[model samples]
Target: MAKLLFQRVADEARPPAILGRPGCGPPDYFTEVLLDDLVKSGAWLDLELKRPFLALWVNDEDFDFPDWNDPLIAIDQANVRKFAAMDPVVDLESLRGMRVYHDEPYFR
Candidate 1:
């Protein structure tokens, strides 16, 4: 299911993130249940670190989680320029090639 969702964003490239936010559903569902399942199940799977996913757990005092979101950014100056060069008005289609999985509210 996750792979399919990512493939929808970029057929050949990897996206930066896979956001899990509650939308009209129980807040606990996104804030707790999913992470619990992942932690228990993550050990069963094997994944490489390169081109890896930087999972972010949104921290809110009201909704606590067993895990925390670790900062996953590790880029040089040149990559910053490459990202900055993007023009939202003209380069909307270029995101796929960039492999940036944004965690902000869903938008395309």
Candidate 2:
């Protein structure tokens, strides 16, 4: 499943984005949940590691995930950009932090 999500994100050439506040609650599991959803939907895109913010991009520009708006996700887009700029090779690290889980089986 992790490989599939990575492949989808790499193939799509879009980075997965994540957002979170400083010292927030437990490592939010939303990213993992969303990753499962994206893979199931066959829309998993690239993973973007912007330090405080990690994001997942779908093929569509307006694609919206309820998780994106979660307060646990980052609230400031600038912070995300800062992280991205600081480390261009952010995806590699982001992928490592991701914890793939076994949820409802997804079929495409």
Candidate 3:
């Protein structure tokens, strides 16, 4: 199963009413519950400590922002830096050839 996610700082910019709150809704019932469990078990935080940064690139146009790649890319970089800061195990300098993607335009 997969889900589209954005880090807190990126999602909360100017208060994202679109992303809404996380929970078990009709469209993402399974992923929602799994995420809740992960939160309770501190799995995501642990992953930040042990794994490379997880990034899912989403088109800004689909999210109601026009030509927002620059800002989105900036957010991606910030997420990596912030995560590295929070977890000593994250080696940003050692991560090479890593990239943020430009997902094909998402359609409703």
CA RMSD per model (angstroms): 13.9, 12.6, 10.8
| Worst lDDT 10-window in candidate 2 | 44-53
Predicted candidate 3 versus true structure: per-residue lDDT over 1-108, tens digit per residue = 333333332233232222324443544333223333333333335443123233321222232233446764454445444544553345544444445432222222
By descending TM-score, how would the candidates be arranged? Answer: 3, 1, 2
- Please give each candidate's TM-score: 0.23, 0.23, 0.32
**Model 1: CA > 4 A from native:** 1-28, 48-54, 58-108
What's the CA error at residue 104 for candidate 2, in Å? Answer: 9.6
Descending-lDDT candidate ranking: 3, 2, 1
Which run of 10 residues does model 3 get worst, by summed lDDT? 55-64
* TM-score of candidate 3 against the unseen true structure: 0.32
In terms of lDDT, model 3 sits at 0.36
Q: Any idea what lDDT model 2 has?
A: 0.35
lDDT scores of the candidates, listed in order: 0.27, 0.35, 0.36
Best by TM-score: 3
lDDT of 2 at 68: 62
TM-score winner between candidates 1 and 3: 3
Error of 3 at 16 (Å): 18
What tens-digit string does per-residue lDDT give for candidate 1 at 9-75? 2222232222344352454333233223233332121122112221222112211322234321222
Q: In candidate 2, how many Å is residue 71 off? A: 3.1
